[model samples]
Target: MIIASEKKRVFIYKDTQLSDPSINLSKEAVLNFYANTYPELNNATIDGPEIKDTELHYKFLSTLGTKG
Candidate 1:
């Protein structure tokens, strides 16, 4: 039996000064994906992604039968 492991890469962004990140997909690349494969997007333009800030609340349960 023979097997090969795939290569892995990591990128760290420290100070590009971008308020947000615009990752790999460029205009041409997105247009290509929209034209060729993903018709269900309803001809949407290739705008960059959006991130929403949401607050999460969690309660920790103590073993003493109390909520912490």
Candidate 2:
């Protein structure tokens, strides 16, 4: 019988899906790594680990919003 090694992880930023991080890293670590590329993530919050098709999905919700 075959067993899955690790669950796939995907990070959503600005409507863009980013999936290129080591599975060893924790959810917070993954966010910090991408913070360099997307400074906006600094003030962002982690959304969910919503499971879909055996894949782990995470979304970086930006704290910055327009004041109308």
Candidate 2 regions off by >4 Å?
1-5, 65-68
Q: Model 1, stretches more than 4 Å misplaced? A: 1-25, 40-42, 52-68
Per-residue lDDT of model 1, residues 4-39, tens digit only: 653221211122112211236543443444434334
What is candidate 2's local distance difference test score?
Answer: 0.87
Tens-digit lDDT string for candidate 2 (1-68): 99857778898887899985887888889889999999988888998989988788899988987768
Q: Please give the lDDT score for candidate 1.
A: 0.30
- The model with the greatest lDDT is 2
What overall lDDT goes with each candidate model?
Answer: 0.30, 0.87
Give the clashing pairs for model 1: none
Best TM-score among the predictions, by candidate number: 2
Q: Which ten residues in a row are the worst by lDDT in model 2? A: 3-12
